[model samples]
Target: MVTAALALCVRTGAGAVIAATVFLTVLSVTLGGSVLADTPLWLPAMPAWPLTATGARLPVALVLGALLLTVSTGLAHRELSRAASR
Candidate 1:
Protein backbone atom coordinates (compact mmCIF):
# COMPACT_ATOMS: atom_id res chain seq x y z
CA MET A 1 0.00 0.00 0.00
CA VAL A 2 2.76 2.41 0.91
CA THR A 3 4.71 1.49 -2.16
CA ALA A 4 1.69 1.94 -4.38
CA ALA A 5 0.95 5.29 -2.81
CA LEU A 6 4.54 6.42 -3.18
CA ALA A 7 4.62 5.29 -6.75
CA LEU A 8 1.46 7.16 -7.46
CA CYS A 9 2.79 10.24 -5.74
CA VAL A 10 6.01 10.02 -7.67
CA ARG A 11 4.10 9.74 -10.91
CA THR A 12 1.48 12.27 -10.00
CA GLY A 13 1.47 14.62 -7.00
CA ALA A 14 0.24 15.18 -3.43
CA GLY A 15 -3.18 13.96 -4.38
CA ALA A 16 -1.82 10.47 -4.13
CA VAL A 17 -0.80 11.10 -0.57
CA ILE A 18 -4.26 12.34 0.38
CA ALA A 19 -5.93 9.45 -1.37
CA ALA A 20 -3.61 6.92 0.19
CA THR A 21 -4.00 8.48 3.60
CA VAL A 22 -7.74 8.33 3.37
CA PHE A 23 -7.64 4.77 2.14
CA LEU A 24 -5.32 3.65 4.91
CA THR A 25 -7.30 5.51 7.54
CA VAL A 26 -10.47 3.87 6.39
CA LEU A 27 -8.83 0.50 6.17
CA SER A 28 -7.42 0.77 9.66
CA VAL A 29 -10.66 1.91 11.21
CA THR A 30 -12.79 -0.62 9.36
CA LEU A 31 -10.46 -3.61 9.28
CA GLY A 32 -8.11 -2.98 12.12
CA GLY A 33 -7.45 -6.03 14.31
CA SER A 34 -8.59 -6.58 17.87
CA VAL A 35 -6.42 -8.08 20.53
CA LEU A 36 -9.47 -9.22 22.47
CA ALA A 37 -10.18 -12.13 20.18
CA ASP A 38 -8.31 -14.44 17.86
CA THR A 39 -8.88 -13.58 14.23
CA PRO A 40 -8.43 -16.01 11.38
CA LEU A 41 -6.67 -13.43 9.29
CA TRP A 42 -3.13 -12.37 10.08
CA LEU A 43 -3.99 -8.70 9.91
CA PRO A 44 -3.55 -6.63 13.03
CA ALA A 45 -6.54 -6.29 15.32
CA MET A 46 -7.57 -3.43 17.53
CA PRO A 47 -7.39 -4.40 21.17
CA ALA A 48 -10.52 -4.75 23.25
CA TRP A 49 -10.01 -2.96 26.51
CA PRO A 50 -12.98 -4.63 28.11
CA LEU A 51 -11.25 -7.96 27.98
CA THR A 52 -8.05 -6.48 29.25
CA ALA A 53 -9.06 -3.79 31.70
CA THR A 54 -6.36 -4.98 34.03
CA GLY A 55 -3.70 -3.59 31.72
CA ALA A 56 -2.27 -6.96 30.78
CA ARG A 57 -2.99 -6.40 27.13
CA LEU A 58 -1.46 -2.96 27.12
CA PRO A 59 1.91 -4.41 26.34
CA VAL A 60 0.44 -6.43 23.56
CA ALA A 61 -1.11 -3.37 22.02
CA LEU A 62 2.07 -1.39 22.40
CA VAL A 63 4.22 -4.10 20.91
CA LEU A 64 1.91 -4.72 18.01
CA GLY A 65 1.46 -1.02 17.34
CA ALA A 66 5.19 -0.50 17.42
CA LEU A 67 5.79 -3.42 15.13
CA LEU A 68 3.18 -2.28 12.66
CA LEU A 69 4.50 1.29 12.71
CA THR A 70 8.05 0.10 12.26
CA VAL A 71 7.20 -1.98 9.24
CA SER A 72 5.05 0.73 7.74
CA THR A 73 7.74 3.33 8.31
CA GLY A 74 10.41 1.18 6.70
CA LEU A 75 8.29 0.48 3.67
CA ALA A 76 7.21 4.12 3.41
CA HIS A 77 10.81 5.28 3.71
CA ARG A 78 11.95 2.96 0.96
CA GLU A 79 9.15 4.06 -1.31
CA LEU A 80 9.74 7.73 -0.52
CA SER A 81 13.38 7.32 -1.49
CA ARG A 82 12.44 5.63 -4.68
CA ALA A 83 9.89 8.32 -5.43
CA ALA A 84 12.37 11.06 -4.69
CA SER A 85 14.92 9.53 -6.99
CA ARG A 86 12.56 9.62 -9.90
Candidate 2:
Protein backbone atom coordinates (compact mmCIF):
# COMPACT_ATOMS: atom_id res chain seq x y z
CA MET A 1 0.00 0.00 0.00
CA VAL A 2 2.73 2.44 0.93
CA THR A 3 4.77 1.34 -2.05
CA ALA A 4 1.88 2.09 -4.38
CA ALA A 5 1.52 5.55 -2.84
CA LEU A 6 5.21 6.20 -3.22
CA ALA A 7 5.19 5.15 -6.84
CA LEU A 8 2.26 7.43 -7.64
CA CYS A 9 3.83 10.35 -5.80
CA VAL A 10 7.11 9.86 -7.62
CA ARG A 11 5.34 9.69 -10.93
CA THR A 12 3.80 13.09 -10.16
CA GLY A 13 7.17 14.77 -9.55
CA ALA A 14 6.24 15.56 -5.93
CA GLY A 15 9.65 14.92 -4.47
CA ALA A 16 8.87 16.20 -0.99
CA VAL A 17 5.73 14.10 -0.53
CA ILE A 18 7.40 11.05 -1.96
CA ALA A 19 10.35 11.45 0.33
CA ALA A 20 8.12 11.96 3.35
CA THR A 21 5.97 8.92 2.59
CA VAL A 22 9.03 6.79 2.05
CA PHE A 23 10.57 7.96 5.29
CA LEU A 24 7.38 7.43 7.32
CA THR A 25 6.71 3.99 5.83
CA VAL A 26 10.25 2.87 6.59
CA LEU A 27 10.10 4.28 10.08
CA SER A 28 6.73 2.67 10.75
CA VAL A 29 7.92 -0.73 9.62
CA THR A 30 11.16 -0.51 11.53
CA LEU A 31 9.53 0.61 14.72
CA GLY A 32 6.71 -1.88 14.42
CA GLY A 33 9.15 -4.76 13.98
CA SER A 34 11.40 -3.58 16.76
CA VAL A 35 8.52 -3.33 19.16
CA LEU A 36 7.27 -6.77 18.24
CA ALA A 37 10.74 -8.23 18.84
CA ASP A 38 10.75 -6.82 22.39
CA THR A 39 14.10 -5.24 21.75
CA PRO A 40 15.64 -3.47 24.71
CA LEU A 41 16.42 -0.39 22.69
CA TRP A 42 15.47 2.98 24.16
CA LEU A 43 12.90 3.63 21.53
CA PRO A 44 9.45 4.53 22.79
CA ALA A 45 6.89 1.77 22.92
CA MET A 46 4.24 1.72 20.30
CA PRO A 47 1.09 3.59 21.24
CA ALA A 48 -1.72 1.61 22.83
CA TRP A 49 -4.16 2.07 20.04
CA PRO A 50 -6.49 -0.90 19.71
CA LEU A 51 -5.77 -3.38 16.94
CA THR A 52 -8.87 -2.35 15.02
CA ALA A 53 -8.09 1.34 15.45
CA THR A 54 -4.55 0.89 14.24
CA GLY A 55 -5.74 -1.14 11.32
CA ALA A 56 -8.23 1.55 10.40
CA ARG A 57 -5.62 4.30 10.49
CA LEU A 58 -3.38 2.52 8.01
CA PRO A 59 -5.91 2.39 5.19
CA VAL A 60 -6.89 6.01 5.77
CA ALA A 61 -3.32 7.15 5.54
CA LEU A 62 -2.71 5.06 2.45
CA VAL A 63 -5.81 6.32 0.73
CA LEU A 64 -5.06 9.94 1.48
CA GLY A 65 -1.52 9.54 0.27
CA ALA A 66 -2.71 7.84 -2.88
CA LEU A 67 -5.26 10.57 -3.54
CA LEU A 68 -2.65 13.28 -3.21
CA LEU A 69 -0.34 11.43 -5.54
CA THR A 70 -3.12 10.71 -8.03
CA VAL A 71 -4.12 14.35 -8.20
CA SER A 72 -0.56 15.43 -8.69
CA THR A 73 0.02 12.84 -11.36
CA GLY A 74 -3.11 13.85 -13.20
CA LEU A 75 -2.05 17.46 -13.23
CA ALA A 76 1.44 16.60 -14.40
CA HIS A 77 0.15 14.33 -17.10
CA ARG A 78 -2.18 16.98 -18.34
CA GLU A 79 0.65 19.49 -18.58
CA LEU A 80 2.88 17.07 -20.40
CA SER A 81 0.16 16.11 -22.79
CA ARG A 82 -0.62 19.74 -23.51
CA ALA A 83 3.04 20.51 -24.05
CA ALA A 84 3.39 17.63 -26.43
CA SER A 85 0.59 18.99 -28.56
CA ARG A 86 2.36 22.31 -29.01
Candidate 3:
Protein backbone atom coordinates (compact mmCIF):
# COMPACT_ATOMS: atom_id res chain seq x y z
CA MET A 1 0.00 0.00 0.00
CA VAL A 2 2.83 2.34 0.81
CA THR A 3 4.43 1.43 -2.47
CA ALA A 4 1.25 2.24 -4.30
CA ALA A 5 0.98 5.53 -2.46
CA LEU A 6 4.56 6.41 -3.32
CA ALA A 7 3.96 5.66 -6.95
CA LEU A 8 0.90 7.83 -6.91
CA CYS A 9 2.77 10.61 -5.19
CA VAL A 10 5.51 10.44 -7.77
CA ARG A 11 3.17 10.43 -10.72
CA THR A 12 1.08 13.28 -9.32
CA GLY A 13 3.95 15.27 -7.85
CA ALA A 14 2.34 15.14 -4.43
CA GLY A 15 5.60 14.76 -2.55
CA ALA A 16 4.14 16.25 0.59
CA VAL A 17 2.12 13.15 1.37
CA ILE A 18 4.91 10.64 0.83
CA ALA A 19 6.70 11.02 4.17
CA ALA A 20 3.46 10.98 6.10
CA THR A 21 2.19 7.90 4.25
CA VAL A 22 5.46 6.07 4.76
CA PHE A 23 5.43 6.84 8.46
CA LEU A 24 1.84 5.71 8.81
CA THR A 25 2.58 2.54 6.87
CA VAL A 26 5.41 1.65 9.18
CA LEU A 27 3.38 2.47 12.25
CA SER A 28 0.40 0.43 11.08
CA VAL A 29 2.58 -2.58 10.37
CA THR A 30 4.27 -2.31 13.76
CA LEU A 31 1.01 -1.98 15.64
CA GLY A 32 -0.68 -4.72 13.66
CA GLY A 33 2.18 -7.12 14.31
CA SER A 34 2.25 -6.28 17.97
CA VAL A 35 -1.50 -6.76 18.30
CA LEU A 36 -1.29 -10.10 16.55
CA ALA A 37 1.54 -11.31 18.72
CA ASP A 38 -0.27 -10.19 21.83
CA THR A 39 -3.16 -12.51 21.13
CA PRO A 40 -3.18 -15.81 23.02
CA LEU A 41 -3.38 -17.64 19.76
CA TRP A 42 -0.02 -16.17 18.86
CA LEU A 43 3.17 -15.52 20.77
CA PRO A 44 3.37 -13.69 24.10
CA ALA A 45 5.95 -11.22 22.89
CA MET A 46 7.01 -9.30 19.84
CA PRO A 47 10.40 -7.90 18.81
CA ALA A 48 8.93 -4.43 19.21
CA TRP A 49 9.57 -3.89 22.90
CA PRO A 50 8.39 -0.29 22.78
CA LEU A 51 4.99 -1.48 21.64
CA THR A 52 4.76 -4.19 24.24
CA ALA A 53 3.08 -1.91 26.73
CA THR A 54 0.65 -0.18 24.36
CA GLY A 55 -2.10 -2.45 25.69
CA ALA A 56 -5.59 -1.42 24.55
CA ARG A 57 -4.30 1.71 22.88
CA LEU A 58 -2.67 -0.42 20.20
CA PRO A 59 -5.95 -1.41 18.60
CA VAL A 60 -7.23 2.16 18.50
CA ALA A 61 -3.99 3.39 17.02
CA LEU A 62 -3.92 0.59 14.45
CA VAL A 63 -7.46 1.33 13.31
CA LEU A 64 -6.84 5.03 13.00
CA GLY A 65 -3.60 4.48 11.11
CA ALA A 66 -5.31 2.12 8.72
CA LEU A 67 -8.07 4.66 8.18
CA LEU A 68 -5.57 7.37 7.36
CA LEU A 69 -3.70 5.14 4.94
CA THR A 70 -6.90 4.11 3.26
CA VAL A 71 -8.01 7.68 2.83
CA SER A 72 -4.61 8.76 1.56
CA THR A 73 -4.46 5.92 -0.91
CA GLY A 74 -7.93 6.70 -2.23
CA LEU A 75 -7.15 10.36 -2.68
CA ALA A 76 -3.84 9.60 -4.30
CA HIS A 77 -5.42 7.16 -6.70
CA ARG A 78 -8.12 9.63 -7.57
CA GLU A 79 -5.52 12.28 -8.28
CA LEU A 80 -3.43 9.91 -10.35
CA SER A 81 -6.32 8.84 -12.47
CA ARG A 82 -7.39 12.41 -12.97
CA ALA A 83 -3.92 13.35 -14.04
CA ALA A 84 -3.73 10.43 -16.46
CA SER A 85 -6.89 11.56 -18.20
CA ARG A 86 -5.53 15.04 -18.80
Candidate 4:
Protein backbone atom coordinates (compact mmCIF):
# COMPACT_ATOMS: atom_id res chain seq x y z
CA MET A 1 0.00 0.00 0.00
CA VAL A 2 2.73 2.41 0.89
CA THR A 3 4.61 1.65 -2.28
CA ALA A 4 1.55 2.09 -4.39
CA ALA A 5 0.59 5.34 -2.69
CA LEU A 6 4.10 6.71 -2.86
CA ALA A 7 4.57 5.82 -6.50
CA LEU A 8 1.20 7.23 -7.49
CA CYS A 9 1.64 10.41 -5.51
CA VAL A 10 5.11 11.27 -6.73
CA ARG A 11 4.99 10.30 -10.38
CA THR A 12 4.35 12.55 -13.40
CA GLY A 13 0.56 12.35 -13.43
CA ALA A 14 0.81 8.96 -15.08
CA GLY A 15 -1.45 6.38 -13.50
CA ALA A 16 0.12 3.64 -15.59
CA VAL A 17 3.49 4.51 -14.11
CA ILE A 18 2.38 3.70 -10.60
CA ALA A 19 0.55 0.59 -11.71
CA ALA A 20 3.58 -0.60 -13.55
CA THR A 21 5.83 0.19 -10.66
CA VAL A 22 3.69 -1.86 -8.26
CA PHE A 23 3.23 -4.62 -10.78
CA LEU A 24 6.96 -4.84 -11.24
CA THR A 25 7.67 -4.74 -7.53
CA VAL A 26 5.28 -7.66 -6.92
CA LEU A 27 6.53 -9.56 -9.94
CA SER A 28 10.16 -9.10 -9.00
CA VAL A 29 9.45 -10.10 -5.41
CA THR A 30 8.01 -13.41 -6.54
CA LEU A 31 11.00 -14.13 -8.72
CA GLY A 32 13.43 -13.61 -5.90
CA GLY A 33 16.65 -15.58 -5.27
CA SER A 34 18.27 -13.79 -8.16
CA VAL A 35 20.81 -11.01 -8.44
CA LEU A 36 18.32 -8.44 -9.72
CA ALA A 37 15.42 -9.28 -7.43
CA ASP A 38 17.09 -8.25 -4.20
CA THR A 39 14.36 -6.15 -2.61
CA PRO A 40 13.17 -8.79 -0.15
CA LEU A 41 15.74 -11.40 0.58
CA TRP A 42 14.57 -14.68 2.00
CA LEU A 43 18.06 -15.69 2.97
CA PRO A 44 20.40 -13.97 5.35
CA ALA A 45 22.22 -11.70 2.88
CA MET A 46 23.13 -14.64 0.70
CA PRO A 47 20.23 -14.48 -1.77
CA ALA A 48 16.89 -12.76 -2.31
CA TRP A 49 13.88 -13.96 -0.30
CA PRO A 50 11.05 -11.69 -1.51
CA LEU A 51 8.83 -11.89 1.55
CA THR A 52 8.83 -15.66 1.59
CA ALA A 53 10.03 -15.67 5.19
CA THR A 54 8.21 -13.89 7.99
CA GLY A 55 11.47 -12.61 9.42
CA ALA A 56 12.36 -10.82 6.19
CA ARG A 57 8.85 -9.63 5.45
CA LEU A 58 8.23 -8.13 8.88
CA PRO A 59 11.30 -5.96 9.09
CA VAL A 60 11.19 -4.84 5.50
CA ALA A 61 7.56 -3.81 5.72
CA LEU A 62 8.15 -2.04 9.01
CA VAL A 63 11.07 0.01 7.79
CA LEU A 64 9.54 0.78 4.42
CA GLY A 65 6.30 1.85 6.04
CA ALA A 66 8.13 4.13 8.42
CA LEU A 67 10.12 5.70 5.63
CA LEU A 68 7.09 6.28 3.45
CA LEU A 69 5.11 7.79 6.31
CA THR A 70 7.95 10.12 7.11
CA VAL A 71 8.25 11.26 3.52
CA SER A 72 4.55 11.80 2.96
CA THR A 73 4.20 13.60 6.25
CA GLY A 74 7.11 15.85 5.50
CA LEU A 75 5.99 16.63 1.97
CA ALA A 76 2.31 17.01 2.66
CA HIS A 77 1.14 20.62 2.63
CA ARG A 78 -2.10 20.33 4.59
CA GLU A 79 -3.31 18.12 7.42
CA LEU A 80 -5.51 16.19 5.02
CA SER A 81 -2.96 16.29 2.22
CA ARG A 82 -1.32 13.04 3.22
CA ALA A 83 -4.50 11.30 4.29
CA ALA A 84 -6.83 12.25 1.49
CA SER A 85 -6.78 13.74 -2.01
CA ARG A 86 -8.92 14.12 -5.09
Candidate 3: tens digits of C-alpha lDDT, residues 1-86: 46456656656556655675666556546654655646541222322433553777567556755776788687767766777798
In candidate 2, the residue pairs with backbone N, CA or C atoms under 3 Å apart (3 or more residues apart, or in different chains) clash, namely none
For every model shown, the clashing-pair count is 5, 0, 0, 3
Worst 10 residues of 1 by lDDT: 40-49
Error of 1 at 26 (Å): 7.3
In angstroms, give how far residue 26 of model 2 lies from its true place.
20
Q: What is candidate 2's lDDT per residue for 1-86, written digit by digit as tens?
A: 33445444545557766676667556555654555423322122222112212543556545655676687667666666665687
C-alpha local distance difference test of each model: 0.55, 0.49, 0.56, 0.51
Worst 10 residues of 2 by lDDT: 41-50
Best by TM-score: 1
Native-vs-model 2 lDDT? Answer: 0.49
Better of 1 and 2 by lDDT: 1
Instruction: Specify the highest-lDDT model's number.
Output: 3
TM-score of 4: 0.37
TM-score of each: 0.45, 0.34, 0.44, 0.37
